[model samples]
Target: MTTLNALHQLDLDHHIHPFTNLAGHQSRGPLLIDHGDGPFVVDAQDNRYFECVSGLWSAGLGFSEHRLADVAYAQMKRLPYYHSFTHKAHSPGIELAAKLVELTPETLNHVFYTNSGSEAVDTAVKMVWYVNNALGRRGKKTFLARRLGYHGSTVASGSLTGLARVHDDFDLPAIPVRHLTTPNYGKEARPNETEVEFTTRLGQEMQELISHEGAGTIAAFIGEPVMGAGGVLPPPVGYWTMVQRICKEHDILLVLDEVITGFGRMGRMFGLEYYGITPDILVLSKQLTSSYQSLGAVIVSDELHDVLVRQSAQHGSFGHGFTNTGHPVATAVALETLRIIETEDLVANAEARGAQLRAGLTLLEDHAAVLSSRGAGFLGAVELVPDGPAGAAGLKAFEIAHKHGLILRAVGDALVFCPPLISSEAQIDQMLAALRLVLDDCA
Candidate 1:
C-alpha cells in the first residue's frame, strides 16, 4: 500500500480538485478519504467522519452500497459500453428513459441523457432554445434565474449559476440570462418585512423583470426547488406559485434544476413534487445513480419534445448530446438505484430523518454562535453570528468540525448540512452532537 505521505505528495503533484482553493490546498494538503462506510467516510488514517453534505449533495444511498456495486459489475460484464446515438439504442438507456418519463409528470414525457448535472442543464438550455426556434420564436432566448440558485458549472449551465466564485475569472453566463434576487428570507428580507410580504415582493420582482425584459424575449425561468449550493435557501411562501403563474401567463418555459433536490433529497421523488408545482423542463442528476456513475437526464414536457422532433427533422439529428450520452452501465446503475430507492422507501426515511435534523438545528439556534437555522427534508443550514468577517465564523466552524469528526460545507457564514438519505436517527444524533461541540469551539 502507498504510504499516506507518498499519496499526499502524489496528489499534490498531480491532482487539480474542483471548487477548491488551489493555493490553500498546496499549503494544507488533502484530507485523503480512503473509503466510505454507510454515511461515514474513512480518512487514510482510519478516522471516520459523517459526510454531512452527502458527497456534494449526491450519494442518496450513502457510500459502500454493495447492491449498486453488484449491479454495476453485472452490467459491465453484460454490456460495459454502448452509446445512444444515431439510430442505435441499448436496453439500459431505453429502460431508464422510460422509467424517468414514468416518474415525471405526464406533461414531461420525454428524457434526454447527459453525463452530469452541468451537462443536463446545458442540454435543457439547448432544448428550450431549439423548441423556441422550431416554434419560430427566435427572440425568446433569454433565461431568468435567481442570484444564488445553483445550476451547474458548464458554460450555459454555469451561466445559469449565480455564484461569484463560480463566475470569477471563468467569464461565464456565456448564454443570455437574467439573474433575480435570491429567495432568501434570512439574508434578503427587509428589516421589518414579513415572510408573506417578502414572498410577495419577490413574486412581484419576477413579474416586473418579465415585463422589463419583454416576456416575448424570455425563453425560460430556471431554479432549484431548494437552492442547495446557494446556502440551502428554500423558497419563501407562495414563491413557486407566483413563478409558475407568471411563466404560464407569459408562455415562458419553467425549468426546475432539481439536480440536488431530486430523488428523495427533499423527502419526495423530485423537488417539483415536494414544492407542489410543475415545470416544463425538469433537470436531474447526482442521486440518479447514487453518484456511483456520472449520469444526468433532462426531462421535457411533451409539447417541447414535439418541437424537438420537428427541429431535429429539419436539422438532421438533435445536434446535441455527449459521447456517453446514455452509457449502458451508467443507465443500468440508475435503474438499480431507482429500484433501491423505492424498495427501501428511502424517501420516507429522508422525511423522518429530516424532521429530526430540522428539530436538532432548531435547538442549535439557542447557541451563541448560531443566528438562525432553516432547511427542508434532509437539507439544512445554520447561519453563524460571525465574530470576525462575513465568512470567517462559518469557515472556522467547518475546520473545527473536522476535529469533532464531521464534514460540513460552508457557503459564507452559513454551514449547510445534507446527510445521506439512509442515515439513521442515531447517526443524526451523533452528527448534531459533533456539530454542537464544533459550535462551542467556534464560539
Candidate 2:
C-alpha cells in the first residue's frame, strides 16, 4: 500500500490549488482531511476537529449524511446522467426545478442549472445581457455590485466581484461593473448615525451612481443579502428595501447572489424572504445540495423568461448551457437534501442555534482582541483587532482554535464561524467553549 508521506509527496508534486499560495503549500504541505463525522472532520492522522465553517459554508446537513449518499446511488443506477439542452430532460431535473420554483419568491418561475456558484453567476450575467439584447436594449450592459461583495471567481462573475484580491493580478472587473458601499453597520456606519440615516446615505449614493452612469447603461445590480467571503456582514436595517426601490426606479435588474445565504442558512428558506424583497434574478448554490455534489441554479422571473423564450424563437437557439447542466445525480442529492432540511426542521434549529451563537460571541465583545460579533442564523463572524498586520489577529485566533480541535476561517481580520444547521444546543455550547479559549489565548 502507498504510504501517507508518499501520497502527500504526490499531491505536492502534481496538484494545483485555488486561492492558495503554491510556494507556501509546497513547503508546509497541505492539511490532509481523511473523512468526516457529523459536524467534525478527521485529518489524515485521525486528529478530529469541529467543522465550524461547515465545509466552506455549504454542508448544512453536515458530513456522513447517508440519505444524500443513498439518493445519489439510486439516481446513478436509474439514469446516471442526462442533459437539459436540445429538448432532452430527466425527472430529477424537472422535479428539482419545480421544487425550487415553489420555494423561491413568486416572481421567480424559471430555473437554469450550472455546475457551481461561479457558473450560476455567469449564467445570470449572460441572461441579463441576453434579455437586454432580445429586448433591443443593448446599451444596458453595465452592472453595479458592492465592494467586499463576493459573487464568484469566473471571468464574468469575477468581474462582478468587488474584492480587490480577486481582481488584483487577474485583470478582473473585466466587465463594466461598478462597486458601491457594503451595508456593514459595524465599521461603515457614521458615528451616532441612525440605521435609517445610514441606509439613506447608501441609497443616495446608489441613485447618484445610476444617474451619473445613465440607468440605460446599467443592466443589473448583484449583491448577497449578507456578504459572506468578503466578511459576514448583514445589511443595515432597511438597506435592502431602499436598494430594491432604487433598482425599480431605474429598471435595473436586482440579482441576489444567495450562494451562501440560501437554503435556510439565514434562518429562512431564502434571504429575500427574510428581507421581504423580490429580486429579478436569484443565484443559488452551496447548501443547495449541502455540497454533497457540485450544483447551482439561476432562478429567473417569468418576465425575463418570456424574453428569452421569444429570443429563442427568433434566433433558433438560446446558445447557453453545460453538458452537466442538470446532472441527475446532483439534482437527486439536492432534492433529498431539501427534504431532510424541511422534515428535520433544520431551519427552526438554525434560528435557535444562531441566537445562542450570537449571544455567546457577544459576551466576548469586551475582550481586548475582539472588535465585534455579527451574524444571522447559523452564519456569524468575529472581527478582531489587528495585532501585527492586517490578518495577524484573525490568523492567531484561527491557529488557537485549531489547536483546541476546532475549525474556523480567517478572512482578513475576521474569524468566521458557520456551523451545521442541525447542530444541537450542546454542540453549540462546545463550540462556544472552544471560542472562549481562543479568545483568552489571543488576548
Candidate 3:
C-alpha cells in the first residue's frame, strides 16, 4: 500500500476480502481507516467513528496502544523471528508460555502456539484425537459442537464452526463432528418455557446426539463460553453447568473457544472463571494480544499434556505445528499486552463499563425497531424487527451508523456492540447516542 489510490487499486485488483459480498465490494469500495486513538478510528477524510465492534471484536485496547507497539518494535529490532520446533526456543516464547500457564486455569499448564484461533482449534482437535488414540480408544474420534457457534475458517476449525454461511457450498463438517442445537434461549426456547427448561432441553439433545453417535466415539465437545459471531448470544442459565456434567460423565474432553471472550473482554481473566467451568483445552486468541499481533494459544490440561508427551515420544515427534508458531515478536507483544491488562485493571473496567453498555442497550429497547438486548461483560447486541429478509435490518443499521460517526457490525438481525475494554463511561454513552441516532434514522 504505497498511497490511498494505489492501495484501493491494489485491493480492487488483487485483494479478495473475507466475509464480504463480492458484488457489493466492487461498487462500495473500502472504508479506508487512516489512524486511531483509544477506542475511536478516523477515516481517510478525518471522519471519526467510535469502533463499536473493536475491529471484528479483536482490538480490545483499540488501535493505538503504544505499549504493545513499542514492545513489538523492540523485539523486532533484537530478535524478530524464531520457531518453537526441534527443541529450539526463544526467551519471548519461554517467558510468555510460563506467564500464560500462570494466568490460565490450573491443570491447563501447557501452551501450544498458533497464528490464529482457527489453528489453535485445529491443534485442539488433533490433540483430542491423539489422546484417545494414545489410550487405545481409536473409535473416539468424533467431535461435538453447537449450531451457530463461530470457531474459525480453517479446514478443521471450520468443520467445528456451526454457522451456515461457513458451510454453505463448502461441503464442510468434512471431519467427523456432530452439531447440537444452539443454546439460544431467546430464539430457540419453546413458548412459555423457562430458561432452566430450555437449558435442560439442550442438554437432552446433547445426550441424544452422543447416544446416536456412541459415547465412545465422541472425543470432545467444543463451544464458545459466550457465543460471539452467533449474534452475541450468551449461554442460557445452567447451560455450562449441564454441559460440563455431561462431558465429564461421558469421558469426553471439553474445549472452550474463547477467541472473543478471552483476556478482559469477559470482565474476567477467561470465560471459564465467569461460568465456573473448567475446560480440558482452552482456545485463546484475539484479545490475547488485543490483536496487536496475530498470536494464538491452545492451553492444555495436565492430564492431556501427559498423554501428548507419551504419544509424541512414541512417534518421535508431534508432527504438527506452524512456521510462525510462537514467533518471538508476536510473543513479546502478547506478554506486554497481558502485563498492561493486569496493571491497568482492564478486567474490572470491563465489568463496570459493561454494565453501562448493557443499560444503554436496554434503554434502546424502547426504540420501534429494537426488539430486545442481549450481552454480558463488554459484549452486547440489539435484536431488530426485520423489515424483509433476515439480517436486512441489522445491515441497514450498520450502514446508517456510519452517518452518525459510529462503526459497528451487524450479526444477522442483531446489531452487535463490543467496544474496547479500555472504553470509559463517556465513550459508552457516546456509542449509545450514535446507535440511537442510527435507529431513529432507520425509522
lDDT (Cα, tens digit) per residue for candidate 3, span 1-443: 39887888778789899999988998888889999999999998799999999998999888999989999999999999888889999999999999999998778899999999999999999999989999999999999998999899988899999988898889897899888889899999999999999999999999998888899899999999999998899999999999999999999999999999999888888888999989999999998888889989999999999999999999999989999999999999999989989999999999999889999999999999899998998899999989799889988998999999999899889998889989998989988988888999887
Each model's lDDT: 0.91, 0.91, 0.92
Give lDDT tens digits, candidate 1, residues 198-281: 999988898898888898899999999999999999988888998898889999999999899999988888888877889999
- Arranged by lDDT, best first: 3, 1, 2
At residue 245, give the lDDT of candidate 3: 98
Which pairs clash in model 2?
none
TM-score of 2: 0.98
> What residue runs in model 2 are displaced by over 4 Å at the alpha carbon?
none
Q: Provide the RMSD of all predictions against the true structure, rounded to 1 decimal.
A: 1.0, 1.0, 1.0
Error of 2 at 32 (Å): 0.6
Of 1 and 2, the candidate ranking higher by lDDT: 1
